[model samples]
Target: MVECGAKHLIYVSRSAGKSKDDENFLHELQVHGCRTQTFAEDVADSSLIKKVVQNAAKPIAGVIQMSMILKVQGTWNLHNAIPGKDLDFFVLFSSLSGILGQIGQVNYAAANTFLKAFVQYRYSLGLPASVLDISAMADIGYVSNRPSVLAQLRCAGMQMLKEPDVLDALRLAILRSLPTPSAAYETTSTMATGFHSVSNPAHLATAVATDTSILDDEETSGELLAIQIGKQLLTFMLSTESEEELDLGRAPSDMGVDFLVSIEIRNSWRQSFRSEITVLGILNAHSLKDLGKMAAKNLKEKFERRNEAMK
Candidate 1:
């Protein structure tokens, strides 16, 4: 909307603080002839919300609610204060974690789930409500602040949303219109609403499936391939330069592999070998040799289980 020659734009946030990058963002909008003003108010505060609305630019066209607390009651307060239902489009930035509960984040999942349901509720009221259950965004937003968390997410098979795709998705969401026929929007969907993972949409489902093990011998091949996969994963984890000169005898910690790197390895191992090696197991290994042995053990267990089931 900024580039489309919008006359007045009102930005409501908790504070008027601007990082150098944020200032650049506002400047770019102004350069595009979009007169922008920032309002400092807590959206969850009923009085503050009303005050902001009363002081807002005339004819509010849309609302994109992205703020929510990490805990239950606090989140509920914010959700209740979500305004502008009578507007053209209301986009709720939810998360896939709501659908597939994340560890130590029960309150967060519940809160996001509420937002997802709110979209449907608005739809029932004949409002333009869209919920985007987005995954990690690489360069911007909350995920970018903690890159280690992002690495862990990658290990868990979460793909990061690229900037271009995100921009396209946002354009679709806010406009609530059919995608334009352009090279930039070629891959984006016309019906890019409801539940969507910015990266892999089917990933959560795949992770949730019960049929995890490659029970058939033909499917996973055998012990030799499993060993190769283990070695390859360890190589990828510990080596900064190349996988050629892997020090299998050296401990991962000694080789400068940290807890997060070990997580990446564990996730890779799970995906490649269809093994159920915990991150703890990966970290517990004294050396690369020990890690390989753990992987081998997991493979052996799967084979044994499949054989026993057959019997």
Candidate 2:
């Protein structure tokens, strides 16, 4: 946030840093010429929270709440602390469970549901707010720590969301200029809500049967699907932080698509997008767009043959 003009930083943690890692962290910030304060106490502790406002180093800033059952209390504490203050953004880290109604997570879902309502409350007061109903991630955070949870999620046919995807959502939340992802539903300046992952193929089929939910134009377009496939290719090739709208004209081989990753690309897209993309095709493709278009055409033919058989 120092890059975004937030010179002074504050931390509200259960434990104050007194380790070597802490020193290194502080040193890094010092190198960047940023000031920071650590309010070494629980945000749930209203009394300690008061002291944070009273003891300001170089003024303070706005709400970005990410807690469990204490989400309501922590956010309340922050909202109570800074009343009538203009905040650039108030981001709440929520979960898909709350929206999709997960079983055996009554309290967990309730806490997240409060974040949904809280954003609306902020809107009522003419304050900026954004809540992300984030999905299960493959790496980092709670899911990565547990194999069983990850297995269960996979068993449920839920596609795992990656860190870059969450970052993209955050960017959309903070900066409205970026176009919302095609799958985003019920989104506005204050909120971008929904999890396409949890809505399994079976569920989608049911929805289609009931005429309750229909696939949009983006989902049906071969060109758009090609772009999506291209992004998946780029994601596998490069690091998480990258341009989703990267130049499609660039050759895949030039972008580090070796023999092994080419095989992986073919296999993965074969199962997901149901394309006949070969390892050789990926390596020999003139451009990423060309590969995507080839995959899209293969998928189209597959769907056509299936339709003919059904008829």
Predicted structure with the largest lDDT when compared to the true one:
2
| Tens digit per residue, CA lDDT, model 2, 1-311 | 56556678877777556668777887788789888777668989888888887887755546567675578899888777765345666778888777776889988888888887877676666666778788788887778889999999988977677775666456545542112223333335433233553222232222222121122222233343445556666667675646545667778787777998888777777666554667888888888667655654555455556646755
- Give the TM-scores of the predictions, in the order they appear: 0.53, 0.59
- Report, for every candidate in turn, its global Cα lDDT versus the true structure: 0.56, 0.64
Q: How does model 1 score by TM-score? A: 0.53
Instruction: Estimate candidate 1's RMSD in Å.
Output: 15.6
Deviation (Å) of 216 in candidate 2: 24
Candidate 2 global Cα RMSD: 10.9
After TM-score superposition, the amount by which residue 266's alpha carbon in candidate 2 deviates from its true location, in angstroms, is 23
Task: Score candidate 2 by lDDT.
Answer: 0.64
